[model samples]
Target: MDQQGNDGWILVETLGDAPTVIAEGTRQRQCRPLGNVYRGRTLALVAGTIASVQASRQPARVLLGETVNGIGLVVARPVLGPGGDVLAVQVFTAPADRSPPAPHRAAGWEWNLSASAGPRRTRWTQEFRKLYGVSDTRPPHAYFGLADLYRRVPRISDIAVLMERVDNARPGESLSGELIARRDDGTLRLVRFVRRAVDTPEGVTLRGVDHDITDRTDAGELAVRIMDSDVAATVHSVAGVHAALVDSYHGYAIKWITAPLPGLSAEVEGGQVSLLHGDDLGAVRPHEPARLPGVARVSMADGSWAPHAVRAFPVPGYGSTPVVMVTFSAARPEQHSQHVGRGRCAVPDCQLA
Candidate 1:
């Protein structure tokens, strides 16, 4: 330990010439201000890693050459100032044996909180293209509109859902959610976008990171995400109709919209429960979004059956049996956008105003 007894660590200021010791630990003896600690090739690698951590303003996990406790990995996360500029990077040591995670892609865009539906000036790291499987050869345009982002984002067709959430966020609060994207090759990949609006010198900027999560999430968990999402709230605001995600296969359904049930469901979980009254065991085919052929007879919280109107929009890439987003309403699609049908509440005898 250093004479001051601080843990051996340093905060390399982005504007400073060298890292200053913020804490001194046992490594105080070996680290030797990194001059003696890192030598030859390792020094060059450490330098580049530091520069990368600064440029991305994202956390980095990198392997270091020189040995101390056999610690091979150096993980660094940057601390930013109020203007969204990097202040310093906190570097710590970790075991290098563990395999690295899927490549993380970072990108962000400047938006007007007052005008979220407007165009956004955007940029992305080269890795960002890899996440969307965008060909590296073509340069990403500097700006994209809501429609453009929506087309690229398959799962969250309503990129507006994300903007709405961020627009309503309180200061310093961050948000996250899952999205499905089909790369140019038509390969469907699940990506999770974690974003937050931070105050910058010019104005507020929306920043986020996108990473592959296809292998990380399960059906049940993905269903729960809808509850966490603003989709239901958005739908509720626009039309009184309820929304849900139905696998239609494996008899699994994630009812994402929030509403009451007239009768008990075959299964109950998350925002809503599943009560498939008929055979829909087969995968839903990729078809044009249209009103389902027949009224859906759903089991109510009570023992009675209610024939509700449903509109299914089959999501792409889940071939044969993709998870379809269905909207339920007592009135027809265009008819119910203004108000829920009178006396047709999901709950029996619950009269509507």
Candidate 2:
């Protein structure tokens, strides 16, 4: 209640701790319509204010108004009751200038690479260098080539399966695999790589991340090797119809075998899986007769089954996953030498009877 009533403005109070308009001294008050603003709002709504409103204090800041008559520096304070508790908020707006705030920069590294023929240009952030231990003096592009990357990998031959998967992946598809690689110090470490393809107007972009998994792979491989060695006998992936022994090593039947199981072999070359359908007829599947460790029956190409035995061991330097050592031998039964000439031993364990 003032002389002109223009400056006195509106007076608000609380009823039972709830804010309510108790008095409106002037129609010129611009903070009135906001009376309803507190209806559904509590002290939690302080975040919407220029500064936090307190029980006995007012926080002042420049608040830009939508209308010409409503522009100003707004000051709002919580009106406390006789019990020193917040009962209502009294808002006052004054004249002030308006200016836009500055832009904010986020923390961390971000990169974008163009998908194109030949070596694609990549934008690497400072964090990228720190992540891969890229030397400040050496350029990052030196490590971009996938084949060149293979040269740095000590166990590239072992991760052939994983590498084939990476190479055969389609756009937008994601693949993750781990392999042992040599760092700049010539130390071999297991690293996990993840890649994703993003289709763009220009072309497809390949995004990737590499992480060190030496601790994890070492622990896992140690456990597998311990368990594998503890087993006196084991059966590796068996040879089936349309299977060909690609490569054999000492103490193992075949290091690599190409089988015709659908989906089992894709993009994997060499002894992983090969087709024997062409004019390569004289290809005889080599059989190691004297190396049998245990007895098991396997199917032959002629549809007939024959007894065979195998012994498997782990082959290191392959990949994060252990390669099995497999050895196959033909099984023979005791026969009658003099009378029957040949007789199958049922259960009587006879030797040349």
Candidate 3:
């Protein structure tokens, strides 16, 4: 099916080696440039298309593809040869950035309040009332007044600053931040608040959702503190890539690492992960890494390779990917088991097993 469905027609077709564009269809608006050689820029998307079909033995859906012009979502199906090998792929582009966000209904509470002020009158979903322990039998205002509501939020010390941000929020854009609140039970809890500005009949109104994030926040902080002892300890993405660098002993976050042990610093900055080599940063290809700890070759500022004993540990709220922490300290003896084959081996006259 094309972006508009099967009624829209096909796009392009090509065959194996000395591979030439055997057929081209309509919708030449952003079609591939003529000629048949595989271009590196679009290689990842094409590979994904073929892989999807081969894996399922049927049509598979992929959200987005990296095209010559930019990224696009497309439906890809394979054209099989007599031997059942994939001969070619037929790709149909889909609408980009046109889909509405999936509605939130499973958890949390929703509220529609007057946009200009603390809600003059507000409506709440049943889920909302249950979440904050609001009484459904009583009138909304009787349960909580605007002033009482403000008192519930313990972190709004600077009311003016927060109000400024809320007032300046653009329509449909979510303004999110964290706050500590004392619920009806008198227990302090951390919550994540998401407020979106919506234009309604009365004027601009604020549509909000609140999700309890106390558990996730507490777990993350505890994990960060526990790993803060290594000289350059960090919380890493599941791929054994650093997500954050920490002052482990002090249980504090470190922002700048102007000087770090040689090669490792180049790969991380400000508790965020990025590729070490700047020149190779243009496009991203889908990848899955091995879960086991191994020796990773990190290219230094001067282009020399340094081996690090990279390890990953699963931590909650880091998504499906585990929190990986790595070390380049030479004080610990290198283990032959850590040798990996992908990069140059740092051990003298040692070949990866």
Give candidate 1 regions above 4 Å deviation: 1-52, 55-70, 75-121, 135-141, 156-161, 217-353
Writing each residue's lDDT as its tens digit, candidate 3 over 110-186 gives: 22344344223334444455555543355532322332233344332222234546545556655555555556564
Q: After superposition, how far is residue 325 of candidate 1 from its true place, in Å?
A: 15
Candidate closest to the true structure, highest TM-score: 1
Clashes found in each candidate (C-alpha, N, C closer than 3 A): 13, 3, 2
lDDT of 1 by residue, 175-202 (tens): 6666766576756666655445656554
Candidate topping lDDT: 1
Candidate 2 regions with alpha-carbon error over 4 angstroms: 1-116, 119-136, 140-143, 217-353
| Candidate scoring better on lDDT of 1 and 3 | 1
Once superposed on the true structure, which residue ranges of model 3 sit more than 4 Å away at CA? 1-119, 135-137, 140-145, 158-161, 217-353
TM-score versus the correct structure, for each prediction: 0.39, 0.28, 0.29
Indicate the residue-level lDDT of 31 in model 2. 24
